[model samples]
Target chain A: MTIVITAFERSPDGGKGLARDTRVRWALEEVGQPYEVRLVSFGAMKEPAHLALHPFGQIPTYEERDLGLFETGAIVFHIAERHTGLLPDDANARACAITWMFAALNTVEPPILELVTARIFESDKSWSAQRMPLVEDRVRNRLGQLSRRLGDAEWLDGAFSAGDLMMVSVLLRLRASGLLDEYPNLSAYVARGEARPAYKRAYDAQLAVNKPTAG
Target chain B: MTIVITAFERSPDGGKGLARDTRVRWALEEVGQPYEVRLVSFGAMKEPAHLALHPFGQIPTYEERDLGLFETGAIVFHIAERHTGLLPDDANARACAITWMFAALNTVEPPILELVTARIFESDKSWSAQRMPLVEDRVRNRLGQLSRRLGDAEWLDGAFSAGDLMMVSVLLRLRASGLLDEYPNLSAYVARGEARPAYKRAYDAQLAVNKPTAG
Candidate 1:
């Protein structure tokens, strides 16, 4: 069965690789999986057909044979569970690796997303200016704790498992905000992730989709 | 090995079963596993000892033998994977179940949490009144889609899997917001979850911990 994932027809990020599909694509590349992408327009995403696959009407919905899944965390985990290279063989290590994945999505990403909402959605609001610092501080607090835990380690845990993949992907969103620079180790960790051949491939692939066509 | 998890010494919700440890305890109950709880103060949660177990410095953290885990999503998932009853046996169904778990935490919960921050953390801010409708509407958008998918169904997918366990838990947070009542099916879905014997036991247990002592 061919694995098919949905991506934005035109990413809001405009090829920055911040779209969730890039993370899913990167996971496929890491696992040596060849997949197909179906681009969905922002309007069509909310249609009943797309909503059937993803109730939230979000991009990066995964379909292969009879199975369909959504949510970047789930897609990435589904890929990692089937791919040997993405998870450790040791039971404890594997469990711990899975822990980091949740930590990235649940604990760390929320504040970062709040910052995004503050900047983009509420930028025109009267209170956006006063609220920016509070939102940024929340991200910094999480980054500080994450940096301390990382503590010069190459990854969040042992080797570069799905945990690191997810943590790096989530941290990448912070680069533009410059909050990540406040923690040098996290900056280096994300840079290391970007340097991976798989990440490079995924980044290029998504960028091509979002890039403007030359005249 | 004994399974030990941490909890808030005094939950801000005052034993409303929203402190996250209740969800982990609920999963354990579904699996018929007895566990011990370690209550930690807010100050201790930020200290080195707790931070080592949970980088984000929040409860509850899971410790069994040498392996320790954190993040309510990860902790609940760890328990669900190691035991039966919480996850389905079918491969595709299992994958879909996990997808809903991610949906609950990543897609749906974020907006609700923002509403939480808006109400509790920033209640005194000048923008709180003006900004609440926006935050609440974001949560409603997700809920509308969720209600559509659920229709008359009892669970997010098939059976009472971890997906429902998580979705129900996540939606429970919205009860205080009253956003859930807008969708009758979602309200009923959460009710079904809370009506479960396992949930009852978990709820009562956490309430015991948070219940104030008589003078």
Candidate 2:
């Protein structure tokens, strides 16, 4: 069955992998799965048609035959569950890998997102300057803990699995804020994730969509 | 094998079920699976012992024999995957249910959490008053879209699966804010979730741990 996923017609990030479909695309690439992308303009995303697939009216809804999945975490998880390259075979490692996936989405991503909302959506507000540091502190607090856990390690837990994939993706959001630079090991870790051939393919694919429109 | 999950020695909410363990307890109860709770004080949660299981040093963490899981979403997802009642057998429905779980955590819960941080953590900061409306508006925007999708529906999708369990859990955080009541359907939807016997069982279980001490 052909896998179809949605993406922003013009990603707000100008084709940066922050658009999340990039993660799914990367996952599919890792597993050597050929998939299709359906770009939805911002307006169409709010309409009933797209909203049915994603109640939250967000980008990156994955559809495979009758199976339609939303939430990049869940979609990536689905891909990991079905495909061979993304998850480990050992039961304990698999469970740990899944746990890391959750950590990436639920724990690590929340604070990063807070920083984003404060900087972008709330920048015009009177409180932006005052609140930015607090949000940054929270992000650093999370990164500090994560860095200690990952001390001198190659990946989060074991070998590269979907957990590392997701965690690296979550940590990448911090690049723009220059926060990841504070943790040398974490910055290097993200560099390693980006160096993966699959990640390169995914980045190039998303970048293609964002290429400057020919005049 | 017996499952051991962590919870606050005394929940900050004093048994309001805001603690992440409540979600795990609810899942176990729904599956009719007996489990044990390991209580960690606020101080203990930050210590290395707890940090080993959860890098962020928060509860609840799940341990069963050799398997240890952190993050409420991952733990709940593990339970749902292992049990039959919490998920659907149909491949598509199951995928949809998983999508709702992600939607609840990633899309819906983040804004609600921001509101909590603004009111509680940042309240003492000079920016609290000015920053609050921005946080509230972001939450309201997400809720508005969610309410539209949930119109006249009992659950997020077809039936009361883990998806509803998580969505309701996320929305419960907003109840005290009085913002949830603004949307009748969403308000009633939460009420419907609360009325479930499983929810009551879970609520009471967490409340037991949070019983106030007599002076």
Interface RMSD of each: 0.7, 1.2
Put down candidate 1 lDDT per residue, B1-215, tens digits, no spaces: 99999999999999999989999999999999999999999999989889889888899999999999998888888888989998899999999999989999998899989999999999999999999999999999989999999999988888998889999999999898889999999999999999999999999999998889711
The CAPRI category of model 2 is medium
| TM-scores for all predictions | 0.98, 0.97
lDDT minimum window of 10 residues, candidate 1 chain B: B206-215
Task: Put down candidate 2 lDDT per residue, B47-147, tens digits, no spaces.
Answer: 98898898899999999998988989888988999987899988878888988888898889988988998888978987777767778888999889889
Would you give me the overall lDDT of model 1? 0.92
Q: Rate the local accuracy (lDDT) of all candidates.
A: 0.92, 0.89
Cα distance off (Å), candidate 1, residue A65: 1.1
TM for candidate 2 is: 0.97
lDDT of 2 by residue, A1-215 (tens): 99999998889998778889999999999999999989899999989899888877888999988777889999998999898998889987888898888888878999899898778887897777876888899999999999999999999887898999999999998889999999999999999999999999999988888778711
Clashing pairs in 1: none
| Fnat for each predicted structure, in order | 0.85, 0.84
Judged by TM-score, which candidate is best?
Answer: 1
